[model samples]
Every structure is written in C-alpha cells, then in structure tokens.
Target: MTQFDAGTEFDRQVRTLIEKGFGELAGLSADAYADLLAPLRATVTDRAAGMEAPTEGRVPFVLVITRELAPIERAVPLLTLGGRKRKPGIIDRHYAEGDLVRFVPAKEVELPDARAYVLFDVDRGEEFCGAIPNDAMATIAGRGRTPLTMEEGIALVTQYPAALAKNKCFSLGGSRCGDRRVPAIWISENAPKLGWCWAGNPHTWLGMASAADRAGSLG
Candidate 1:
C-alpha cells in the first residue's frame, strides 16, 4: 500500500486509512498502489460520464480495499446484480463464495471514474461485516426474526408499537407499492409496489429518509 502523512489532503479523503493501519496500502506492489492513487490525484476528465462535480457540503468519499485483491477489469454496475429470476432492487441479491465484491456504497456516486468509492472486495475476504447503514441493518437485524415485506416494514415503522420508525427506510424503485417516484415514510406507511425497501447505504438512507419526511409532510 501507498504511504502518506497523517494530515495531508490525500489522507483526509481515505476511508481505510485507519483500517490500513495509518494509510499503508498493504499487499499491493508499488505500481498497483500508484494505479489506485492516480484517480485521486487527477481531476475529473471532460469525457467522464455521469460524474457529479464536487459540491459544498457534499459527502467526500474514500477508497477502502479489503487488503490484497484487486478489482476485476469488467466492473459490474451494482444495479445489475440481481437478474430476472429474482426481481431486481427488491431484495439484496445473494452472491456465491467467489462471485463478486459485495459492498455497501457510502454515498451517491454516479461517476464512472470514481476510484475513491470502490467497495471492499468480498471475493478476497475483506471484513465488511458488523454495523452497516439503517436499511440493511434493519433487514439483517430482523433476519429470520421479523417480517421482511414492505407492508410489514411500513407497519413496523408507522402503526402502534412501531419498531423501525426511528431508523430510516426506503422502498425500491419499482417497489410493490406501485409508486416509483414517491418515497415512503413512517407517517405515510404506504407499501411500495415492488414490496420491499433496499436503501443501499447510509447516504441513500439520508436521501430516502428525507424524501419520506417530505412525502408525509413531516418536514
């Protein structure tokens, strides 16, 4: 891994600095380390597709590698994870032992060249388990213990004895409730057309929670 000073601009943008034991890029050759660092050093290119310009108050991102494994050349867009057999976006798609790197996005990153936002590679056995964001947290916490459907999840948040109300929740785009444009919240308690919420990460939870607040006129 590449080495950096404690408080440099580069160090600030790194998420795995602490994890990497003071920002050391372990197990990678010097050339590979440089390849990973190049994107962070370079400016957004003119041909960069779907890249959002840096904005004030926008969440800064960092790259966290799971130690040794490098990403595959053909990166699969996360949205395409679950194919036809399982409805996409309804539930987290199950991955095989060495399928692909399953990562939770920390924020909304549309940039094709977003080297900083690459998730930890599960294929290489990175430790990503433990407290994740609200939605996935809710799901995992309720795994085998509670109802996982959209209706039940909404009830769990909205009705009396609402359990998940405190934590933010979001239904998938084509959710069972039928409205893709509008987001659901505690007050609304509406089941999505697709029947489930899959707010992928913390940043997504923030957006969904805010949208839910607005939709229910809570804000």
Candidate 2:
C-alpha cells in the first residue's frame, strides 16, 4: 500500500482547501506549514494519516490535526468544551455570504438563538483519521468554546443561513456529509493519479473553478 505521511496529506488538504476556497499562492511551503502548526497538534501516529475513530459523547469535540509541513508535531484542540478562544489549527475564513462553514470558528451560543447549536462536527480523533477509540490518546486542545451551550448552538444554526448552508462536515469512512449532487474533487498535479477533494460551498472561496476548471476536484 502507498503511504504518504500525515504531514504531507495535511499539506495537500490545506493547499486544496485554500486553493479552492481562498488563497492563490503556489501551495504550502515549509515556513507556511510551520506557521499553521504553531498551536495545533501533530501526532506521531498514523492518525495524522487520516485513520480516525468515533468520539461523539466526549464534551469538547477534539480535532486532532497535523502540522502538515513538519512531522515533529500535531494539533489537538477541543472545540466543543465551551470557550470563546479560537485555536491555531482552526481559522475563521471570513464573513462572506453562504460561506461560513460550521467548521470555521464561532461562538455558536453567543447568539440568542438556542437551536443554533449545530456545528459541522469534524471528528475528534488521533493516531490516524480512522483509528478506533483509544482511552489513553491525548485530547485536542482543550475547551476553546466553553462560553456556550447546545441550545444556543442550534439557534445560531437557524439564524446563520450562510453557516447552515455551508456546514458540510467530513469524516473519512464515516457517513457521507455533503450534498451528494455537488461534484467533489480536484486532480492534484503532485499526485495526479490520486484525485484530491476541494469540498463544500464555503470551501469554494479559494480558487476552485467549476465552469472553467476541470471536474476532477472533489468539492
């Protein structure tokens, strides 16, 4: 089986996301990778490679991330625990219309709407993207969203049409999360045989061209 390190996969994902959703830079560089990794977790295990497990009930949802440029570290932050702080691995792209993906950082409870508590719910895992549950594994960064409750989160979801419409969460080997009708990927020149994914509407802010671009990008 062919195996690229978690960092490399992360680099490809970030580049694809930024390239399709926002940035136009050539791709991620060593310096830029380091910059993105400053506060996130970079596990030494295969979890960085996309093998993950189900972590639903644990308070504070964990998103175990890789630096993508460097193998020396990983990013594990807890977004569901309730705090107002945004961890480094997480980024708020912008306030664009219908472009606010729930994965982007926001205090869902701050709004008066109680039913807006829905988040894109990216899985909290480690060792690999699809690894089974391991009790000893380290949790992602702790409690960055401690300031809110579930009721408010639901309300925000109802109020923010953009975020709700764009809230397409993903999980490898998990159930399909996005609109099935939407085309889902980009062909990577670096790894041409392995077509890459560009995913979701909010993620479309990057440079992902549908009309002019090819259909290989898995958006």
Candidate 3:
C-alpha cells in the first residue's frame, strides 16, 4: 500500500475542518482556526520526516480534534455517505453526550491532552472481523496495539470514508461504557451510523478498530 504523504494528509484534515465549519463551532473564525493549527503542522512534519511510509496496513497518521473543540454531535452530521448525502450520523437516543463521559479509554490506549492530536498507524481492525467485541479487545491487546476511541473513530471516518466499507465496518472498542455496550460505526440505510453493540455479541461485518499510538502537544 502506498503511504499517504504526511503533509498532504495534514493539509487535507485542516481543510476538511475549515470547510465543515469546525472553527465556528470552536468559536473562532476559519482563518483563526487555520492559524491555530499552524504550529501543529511543524510538529507533524518533523515527526513524519525521514520515516518510510508503510507499504501495507495503516496510514501514517490522522489528525483528530477532541470533543472539547469539535463536539461529536456536530462532527457526526458532517459525515456523508460516499461524498453524497444519505443520512447524517446519529447518536442513539438511548444515550447522550453526558453519558459519553462514562466511556473511557481502554487499557494501553493513551490519548493526548491537547485539543488536537495525531493518531499514528490507525487500523480498522479488519483482522478481528467476526470476533466478539470482548474477545476482539483481548486479541488487540495481545497484538500490542490500542483500540480506537469514539473520537478517534469519528476522526478516521471523517478523514477516510472509504474505511467504513459495507462488510468491513469497525467498532470503537477503546471506549468502554462499563457495560456491554461497545460503540461502533457501520453502514445503515446506505449511510454511516454511530450506534452501540453488545460486547458479548459478534458481527461478521464488524471488527474492532485500533492504532499503534498517539502524539500531540498541549495546544
């Protein structure tokens, strides 16, 4: 697989956010938001410099803005199906953002404290397809990888809609609700939908998503 150019990917993410009006949501003008991300560009460039792009598997890195800056409610609606409008991503009515706090990162998955950060070597966990969520989590940990969080999941789909393929969708196993409900992103009504699945259950079409690590400065 050809590796994505880090700088180009970074620029694309910035443009996506601006075009999606994330700056306005953050209470800043588009120009101001771009300016805010300027410093991070240098950091990403430096980190990616001299690194060989992977020939297969995950991309180099993905830029992610936390819920504090880009709320999920707003970000989800921005997602489209195959670059066309189908149905906006919806958070199941049974839960709300306040309940999101209960879903913390799984063990070995450390997130950055900054409002924006980069998720390195993200995998949609295709290998774990057909595996139960609980079992999948163990397998991911055994592989010395970290599962993707809900924010990171949204970030991944936001940047790469192709990742949410029909039969190869993924679950955000990193964010556990202290119950059986594991958050997931899958195709529904020919659109991307954010919903929950029981941890004990398994779906042949869904695997757990993960990443190698994360990095960012406190911005």
lDDT of 3 by residue, 84-171 (tens): 6556676776677587667777666677754788887888888888999989998888888888888898888877777888788899
RMSD of each: 17.7, 18.5, 2.7
Supply candidate 2's per-residue lDDT for 188. 21
In lDDT terms, which candidate is top? 3
Q: Cα miss at 83, model 2 (Å)?
A: 39
- For candidate 3, what is the total of clashing residue pairs? 1
Candidate 3 clashing pairs?
Answer: 1-55
Candidate 2's residue-wise lDDT over 73-178, tens digit each? Answer: 1111111111332222221223233422212222221221111111222321222222221111112222232211112222121122122111122112111123
Q: Using lDDT as the measure, what is the rank order of every candidate, best first? A: 3, 1, 2
lDDT winner between candidates 1 and 2: 1
When 1 and 3 are scored with lDDT, the better candidate is 3
Clashes of each: 11, 61, 1
Q: How high is the lDDT of residue 99 in model 1?
A: 30
Best by TM-score: 3
- In order, candidate lDDTs are 0.25, 0.23, 0.80
| Worst 10 contiguous positions by lDDT, candidate 1 | 210-219
Better of 1 and 3 by TM-score: 3
Candidate 2 residue-wise lDDT at 142: 26
